[model samples]
Structures are given as C-alpha cells and as structure tokens.
Target chain A: MTVAAQSEVQVDNAEVRVTEWRLPPGAATGPHRHGMDYVIVPVADGEMTIVAPDGARAKAQLKTGKSYFRKAGVEHDVLNETATEIVFLEVELKV
Target chain B: MTVAAQSEVQVDNAEVRVTEWRLPPGAATGPHRHGMDYVIVPVADGEMTIVAPDGARAKAQLKTGKSYFRKAGVEHDVLNETATEIVFLEVELKV
Candidate 1:
C-alpha cells in the first residue's frame, strides 16, 4: 500500500479554504473529487503522477512559485513518485 | 518614487485568476484594492511593507511555502523592503 500524504488545513474562512499538502516519495493522496473550484500553488519544483478514476494516468510537472486552477468535480489520485518530498498549497474557493 | 513591482498573470478562467508577483528591493505594488477573495503563497521568506490609502504603514512577514488568505475589499500598497527579490503567487477566487 502507498504511504498517505500529509495534509494540514492552514486557513478556512467564509471566502476560502487553504490546505497545505506534503507528499514524501511513494506517498499518495488517494482518489478524491474536488467539491469546489480550487487553485494549486506549488512550493517546490517537482512532478506528480495523476491517476484518474478510470485508471488513466498522467504526469503533472510543478514549478516552484507557480500556480494553476481547476473547476469543481475533478476526480483523481495524486502521487509523489520522486525521491524528494513535494509540497503545495490548495486554495479552495468557498464563494 | 518607489519602483513599481511586476505582476504576471499566470492563469485566468471562470473560477479563478492566478498572478505571480515579483518585487525587487524598494519596489512597490502601488496602492490598490482587492475585488475578490484571495490567497497569497510566498515563494521565499521575506518582509513587505504595507501602506494603506491613508498612509498608515505595517509590516507583513512571509514564509517560504506558506500561504494566507484575505477577503475582498482589502486595500494596500505592498513593498519589498529587503535586499533580495521577493516572489509570490496571488490566487483570486472568482466565485
């Protein structure tokens, strides 16, 4: 079984919720679906393996200080396959 | 006159707008107001001088990889007072 990644809720208010995720090598966030629109801010340069619900797989390259956004209802499992730990912040819009 | 900081839009979609901000020493973002709720993810440890419209000043300390959120209607001018360039991502939620 893959090790579970660590997630910490940094902030949650009326307008937004921010969570920080730390993924060690071989760690995974397990399959999940986003309930709200979200933005991802990568803390370091790294890559993640994205596994879709249908078993499709893809690689996501993340650069330090870069951010991206996605709409709600996306389902996937994120895995850290690199030797180094990967850290990122997920900002969920509550509006 | 304080030099103006640089802002680059990284992503703009129906749900969110992501911008990367770079502030060199003594650069400022000029006084502005936030229209949407937002989250800021710092790329490096640094300090910023915040100047309000009334000239009130405050200091904001930022940590690398850490994030914070604010509601809309926040108005201030952000300045980089350190010698090193400071970088961060501003994720605005378009609810």
Candidate 2:
C-alpha cells in the first residue's frame, strides 16, 4: 500500500489523525515509508531510536509535551528502548 | 461561532492545511480563542506580534523552520510587522 490506514478526527476545518501503536520494550517499528510530510512527537515519555534512510540513526529520549517535524518522503523507523509502553504521536500532514 | 471556517487538504491517512493569509504590515489576527491544543509555526519568515489574553504580549521574529506549542483555551493574537506578507502555520489537535 502507498500509505497505511490511520485514525483521525476533525477539529473545526482542520483534521488531526493520531496513530497509537503499542510496542514492547526494545521493540521497533521497522522500515516504513510515507507519502506526505509529517511531524513526530511522543505522547508517552520514553527513549526511542530514529533510523534515517541513509542507514544513519539517532537515539532520543522523547518528552511528552514536545514535538519535532519531519519532511515528506523521509524514510525512518523508531524503537522503544524502555521497559514500558512507548506511545509516540505521529502527526502527518494530510494534504 | 464555536469555531471558524478553515481550509484543509488531505495527505495519506493524514491531513495538512496551509493557511496562507496575506497580512498588512502591523496587522493582527485579533484577540482570538481556541478550543483544542495547538502548535504554532511560521512558514514564511518575518516579524510577528503575539498578544496573550492576560494583556501581556511579546514580539517574536519567526523562523520558517521552527515550531512552538500552545495549550487549549489560550487567547492570543498575532501581527505582521514586516512590509511583506507574514505567513504562519497553526496545527491544532482535532481531538
């Protein structure tokens, strides 16, 4: 599929979709892709690994109240390195 | 109105809307309010004025690639202090 199915809701004229996937400790989202630009933010505070398309990756301890941006066609993956559930907020631009 | 009319575009399983309003130099968004949480980011780099509901205000020279988040029900206004258009991106949580 070009894109995976997501859950969304409407806010006024704007629509916000949230993808909440559970991952075990030391689990990963594996290699995936997107069709549009997206913003990555963690809902549940934890440590994560973001693997870039160029085989480069970075480890980030995500904060619950902070957010970062991602561009379109930027391939990446994430991993939960903590012993608890790692809930991340991925807000992709639905355009 | 509970919420104002807005324009939206859909991405793959996500949506991203570009609210490109041309503001005159020193123009403001007025004393407006919001229902949900929101993230504030500028698309076009320029000067802006953000006035909070508490009668306090601050002048922010916005960057095109940075973003900030605001909680729900925070009343604020923005102004463009530049001769050119001051474009900004506001992504509100739909839930």
Q: Could you give candidate 2's per-residue lDDT for residues B1-95 as a string of tens digits? A: 11222323222223333233445676666778877666654445777667787878797886553555556788777666567666555566543
lDDT of 2 at B41: 48
Which tens-of-lDDT digit does each residue in B1-95 have in candidate 1?
78779999999988788999999998989889999888889999899999999999999898987888888899998998889888899888887
Best by TM-score: 1
For candidate 2, list the clashing residue pairs, or say none.
A94-B10, A94-B11, A94-B14, A94-B15, A94-B16, A95-B10, A95-B11
Q: In model 2, how large is the Cα lDDT of residue B29?
A: 67
lDDT of 1 by residue, A26-86 (tens): 9999999999988888898899999999999999998988888888899999999989888
CA lDDT, candidate 1, residue B76: 93
Candidate 1, which CAPRI tier? high
C-alpha TM-scores of all predictions? 0.94, 0.44
Q: Which residues of candidate 1, in runs, are more than 4 Å off?
A: none
